[model samples]
Target: MENREESRLTSAELANLWRLYITENLMYQFKTPLIDNCQDPDIRSAIEFSRAISEHYIVSIENIFRNENYPVPTAYSENDIHPQAPALFTDVFCLHFIHQGAQLGMSKIHEMMAVAVRQDVWEVLNQGANDFKDLYQQSLQLLLTKGLYSRPAFLPPEKESRFAENKHYVSGWLGNQRPLNALEIMSIHNTIIQNGISKAILRAFAQVINDKKLRDYLEKGAETASDIMRELEDWLIMENTNVTATLDSEILPTETPPYSDKLMMMLIANVGVGSLGVYGNALSTVFRRDLGLKFMHLMKDAVQYAQEGLHLVIDKGWMEVPPQFPDINTR
Candidate 1:
């Protein structure tokens, strides 16, 4: 027990904490202003709750690093954001953002706990998971109350047990194909939702940033998101489905920059990672041949957009180095 208490951090625990620290910092930047400008009391309450927890997590992680005699990550701070800036997103958008963030927070918590070895790390992850779960529930309930929840395409119940008796079950590029399964529809639903947010973010960033080159890149991301969303919507339309999501109008008319360009670029780069994972999962799980091809194409575009953002981040000298192993002349 004594030895365990004094042990160094495991690789998984260290990596998870590092990623969470930076992501949470970015979130804090967005939440700080949203919470201040939010008009809906219910939405504001939930955002406030989430922001408080994020602040606690940040300080807790800093203490953990200090105890380990290691340097705490220099993540975002006040300099990276202007909490008093003009409104950039509506209160409804704030609610949706918090809802989405809570979902991501839960995902991170699961990964954090799965590989956590130390008892202290487990405590933090466990508590964080429970808190995020609560936040998720709270935000979802608020969305439902406000009639803002974007549900996936509804699938009818199976009338009887069935089996795929032929190869045509997997075919999608030909005539008279099988209807989409719940999983496939759900995947499309999520992709549309993400594209909605990503496109809006790119548009917002493009409006505020002055760099012509990066603005063009941001516009490309927005266009890619829009194109993919339209294709996915067309697929859903064949099945008599329509998904209503975040609108471009949900963004305010403010031309002022709320977050630094570095933060905006980082957010886009993170979207690239999230998009690849979402598309990859859809590719593997979706049964239709056409859907698989569609994800592959969308994944290619996502990769290209992300690559551009990464190059910009590197060129701007905004990319920070993570802890690395010493070069042992690996020749």
Candidate 2:
């Protein structure tokens, strides 16, 4: 007979549940303001869907934690948001926020589902993943209908496929290099788009963040993001192709903050970390020495930014501790 009653939660299950509990609450905190400030009906609907899904996950995760006698972390609450505050971001930004968020959330849900061992945990996570997929599709369609979706540059088919002929194909530093390949162009193009989004987020964040030092850091981050985007755009322009800008160049002047400083820092830092991952992936895909070198430098800068952001949050007591193994040595 299986001992279902006495079964202990695996570490993976515990970690997944704990992290999602925190993440869902964070999502709720942001979505509340977005929903309140959103002017576009389509954007409002997407935000509502995302917030509803997050609420469902939070409730389910809380139930699991309670059943297992685990103390839930004090995640964000109504105190962290101000619904009546002036709109800090535009409707387009809010729409993009939901679209990007759903993509990242779905990826995480799939990862959690892959490692989940408990039957109940697996079911919950799998359901979240399916819901996010639907949400992503809906948000994407809305963006397309509004002409707000900026796709990566497309490559036309060549007369025929050909193998690399000489050493110059991969060379870039010491000698003449061949023109950029389709894959290299694609990687650089995608990196530029991500950088644009990061820059826009940080620019908006810098405007509302009150702490002088932290605001300065966010401004510096925005400058770094711009530098990266410009570099990548230059590479694409060298190939005589049009570059698609993913973020709006203008931000409304709004000093009123919709989210707490802690929440803003956390969200910006999360985006910085995600951008670093994108840079690393692009680095791996580009074979040209120049392209690879650019990605490496950009990634190094992103790492520095992310580390600084983490330290700031920790110093401010805004960082949450995740689940960890017990200190057996001390015991």
Candidate 3:
């Protein structure tokens, strides 16, 4: 048996660990201020729980990196944190962030775990997944108790299962479309919620950024988020479904940033890039011809905006170079 437990880190394990370290580091940075500024005790406790878990993961991965003789990624650090900065987001938003982040983290951990060859690596990823799953449950319970979470649109139980009657059922995102099936409804609700979060993040980042060009760029992104949400919500409306919560009020008026402008830009860019994947996945699942086309249109705009943000980050020298294989084909 190949003892992966003692084996050298494969490229996949290295890459996943690097990505997870950066992700956990970002969460820890945000969680510190969030925990300090949180009002409600329950929410504060939940965030504290999340922060603790994130710290554990951060230390774990750092140790692995050191053991492997791999220089740790300087993703974000104390340099990015502003000690005197006031609350940049509300308590509700903090809870929501933890809730959504934990939920997403579980999925991410599983993805990493799939690529992991080492037994030790699996253990770390597994533990991280379990920890975040608990946090997800905790944050969700609090959001439900506080009436903060917008429940997904209810799918009425079918009296009897039946096959699609005709081609009309494949009608798209607009016009006289048929009622949404389960996957379609889930896709719409998830996209709406994601855009809502994106809008709030952009608004909050726009408030603290000092660069006029960056601020203008963030504001435009926020507008794009609004446009995306509006179209997705229209789908819900057409199906007579419940829309997701608005996060505008969650953004605080603090002009002071908790994170550096560079950090915020990179973080927001990550969000934009991630959504493109979600849209692509949705395209494959959503049966409507026009609905797929709509995703194509939205994805095109998102790609452009993300490219613009990338240029700004590169210009500022804030973007870190990712680990890459040297181009041997140059010869």
Candidate 4:
């Protein structure tokens, strides 16, 4: 056994310690929706696999911390779990979310592991990377088997021509006709509340992930989201708009995830589309350059999030295979 006092943690060790803290936080967040309302058998199985893997990683890291005589960060704990919260997603949505989360986690983990130095820590991270790869593969197979996946649609020649000719669309301005008002400010505040809820959910997931790399990525995202939320709230107060820090009571009750992955996919896709519309409108309506920039930033991040989700769908084979384009004649 490595001597507790003699096992000095290197910079690599310190980084991993922070990573473990963050991933564990995410795992805790994911567990609630998985246990309370996920309905699809296949998705539930995947969640079970993820939960198990995260738990193992957490234990391994904790052992390492103890052996090295380093104080473990208390970023994740039992308090993070929300077993009593009403189901927020149908089984289908739950599976889609899991797949998306896994893809994001994997991408971030790969980046982190590339920089890791400790042989033992690197080995553990590699194991996790492999597990997530397998999980992504399995998810694709399952989606293909169920005919739940679909490829992006190809635009017809006429449609493409029309889109190319259409120049009326504004790029950065708010699309709304009037200047910013109290009602519009209130609407923006609501958006902030929605964003906060999303952060809370992500924070929960962070609590359970074991990989240091994966945890750090989640923690960074959480921090970014929190910053945006604060900014939005401050803007609302500055405008003297009545805004509530909490979510409205009328938000739909959390439902069991649907069995169909397609529904879930559409739901998330629509959210991305909706954000584009909202941001576009804001650009046209709001005259302030700073506010417009903030909206653009939020929209850009949403696009990235949606793209990551789409990649998972494609990787898992839940979407339809794309048709090959005709090759140009070389002669």
Candidate 5:
């Protein structure tokens, strides 16, 4: 079934297209409702832009698939969006969601562009990356203007360049431990902020979702986020720094869901994987033994939760199979 055409899509190109197509579908499903219910002009504009970006990617990728004669995977449909539903999140919280989405989009674009080889495929993904970059900048500026953006804790100017002088810098488990360095502090602060936002999203989803099992699972995910945030907060408090704001007070009492349980579970799974990545990255940056151990524990819990969500996605048949190599066993 391999295409003999000179411009035929490579397996990597097909995989990237498929992955982003699924993501764009989720974007459409999530953003349409947000756009309809969004009250803040600034937030609405950003959501519109974000939604447009996804829509553009979807159309562009589908064209590539069409030209290549590969059947596009079935993704979310219009039925997935509930625009008439009451606002599940406040304007400020919605803005936060878009901002975080932009950040994650940029990260994903980098991953996608890395493996893309086809000229046409790389062009499309590169353009998508630039679009996300612009969206990230715009959303960030809007968040800052509205005073909703949480800036990382500032460190004092370094008086001089220095390097770790002792083995204790690598392992602080024994003897006298040094205060947390800027790198360690930055990791803790960033992780706590991410967990806070994730908790808010999970809390809102849990409140509106009807399926008892999914709702219960979403609540559990929120609790896990809260636990991790509390531990991170303690570390920040030890440094006498204030923690970032949580959006719990901002979530509305809307009993109706803006998205279906299936969509919600998919979002949960996506965010769970991102959370695990953040923890994994932080583990590498943390210098203290205790801090590294803490990240490991949090990562373990996040992985377990993500696996549960993925299993549900599979059981419900929401998990789309990605492009794969031909099976030699059958051959």
Candidate 6:
């Protein structure tokens, strides 16, 4: 037996501990009621797959800890779904929310994996990261196949010639010429509420996420978003602005989600990633440097989520098929 005095935990060992910590936590969060409510079977499957992988990882990590004569890290504790709380959403919506959360988690993992000190740990992370990429791709495919994915509502004009004649540059760096109008104030308030909703979504995912590192990262993101929302509200109040903090409940589709639980979750991740650019541009247009800095942070988080979601999609062969190359020899 290895002595306790020795640094028994190698980089690989530590990495496994981190992996197991996240997976076990996730297993509890993704139970039958949660699974049953999912609209997409593919999404449900993916979650199950993730759970299985995590379980395997946990076992592997425990073995490593045992071999190294190190005490295994205690990560997962209880499967406590509070009795008092009402069900917040249907299974489909829950899956979708969780999927977005996973994207965020994967993104954080990719960055940390890049800077991992141990080669073995890096290798493990690299493989796991690729798995997430596959998952993302599969989710996208399911969305497309089911025709449930939401396309960007605002489409540019169809005729290229029509765009050539119209050119207008609107400038508002020093604030709008007129004092911020009611409409503009309302828009700002709407944005803040949207931000809050997104933060809540992240928090929900963090609760169910299997990875400790990912959970920690997501929790941090939720906190950061909450802070930004508070600041935005404060600014609105100072300007005597009327903020419409409530989300438009009628906007989101109420139709039963068409896909399986797993697939639906994947779809949600894709949508969330797709929305990042819009958020980035919106903030850039309306906010000053002080506010802009917070937006930048938000952008960073969005990019991370997008990258991870994309990785999952690609790995799963769910994205659009690449075009076939012409036969050079025949040509």
Off by over 4 Å in 6: 1-20, 31-33, 36-40, 77-88, 117-120, 146-173, 176-331
In the range 1-331, model 6's lDDT, one tens digit per residue, is 4465553445544654565444444443444334544455776786665555445556655665577665665533332333233333544444444444445446755766755655545665666667667656665565557553433222235564432222222233454433333334543554465555566655655555454554565566667667767776776766765443422231233223222233323433534543474455556565244444555666777778667655655665544332234789998
lDDT of 4 by residue, 224-328 (tens): 667777787777666455444432221335432311233234333433444455555555665455566788788898778667656755664544322233567
What are the lDDT figures for the candidates, one per model? Answer: 0.83, 0.83, 0.85, 0.55, 0.84, 0.51
Which pairs, if any, clash in model 1? none
lDDT of 6 at 74: 52
Give the residue spans of candidate 4 off by over 4 A: 1-8, 82-85, 147-150, 153-296, 299-331
TM-scores for all predictions: 0.95, 0.92, 0.93, 0.48, 0.94, 0.46
Model 6 accuracy (lDDT, Cα): 0.51
Give candidate 3 regions above 4 Å deviation: 1-6, 173-175, 327-331
- How would you encode candidate 2's per-residue C-alpha lDDT over 67-148 as one tens digit per residue? 8888888888898887777887788877777787787788778888888877888888888888899899999999899998
Candidate 6 has a TM-score of 0.46
Residue-level lDDT tens digits of model 3 in 195-293: 888899999999999899999999999998999999889888878888887899989888888888878898897678668767876777788887778
List candidate 2 stretches off by more than 4 Å: 1-7, 246-250
- Worst 10-residue lDDT window for candidate 5 reads 1-10
lDDT of 4: 0.55
User: Where is model 1 more than 4 Å wrong at Cα?
Assistant: 2-6
Pitting candidate 2 against candidate 3, the one with the higher TM-score is 3
Tell how far residue 105 is off in model 6, in angstroms: 3.5
* Best first by lDDT, ranked: 3, 5, 1, 2, 4, 6
In model 2, the Cα lDDT at residue 216 comes to 99
> What does candidate 1's lDDT look like per residue over 1-331, in tens digits?
5585557887777888888788777777767878888888888999999997788678888888899877888877889787768988888878887887787778768978999888888888888899999999999999899889988877778899888989988899989999898889988988888788888888988988768898999998888888888888888888998766656888889888888888888877876777787788788889889888898998997887777788888999988766767789984
Off by over 4 Å in 5: 1-6, 327-331
What's the TM for model 2?
0.92
Ranking by TM-score: 1, 5, 3, 2, 4, 6
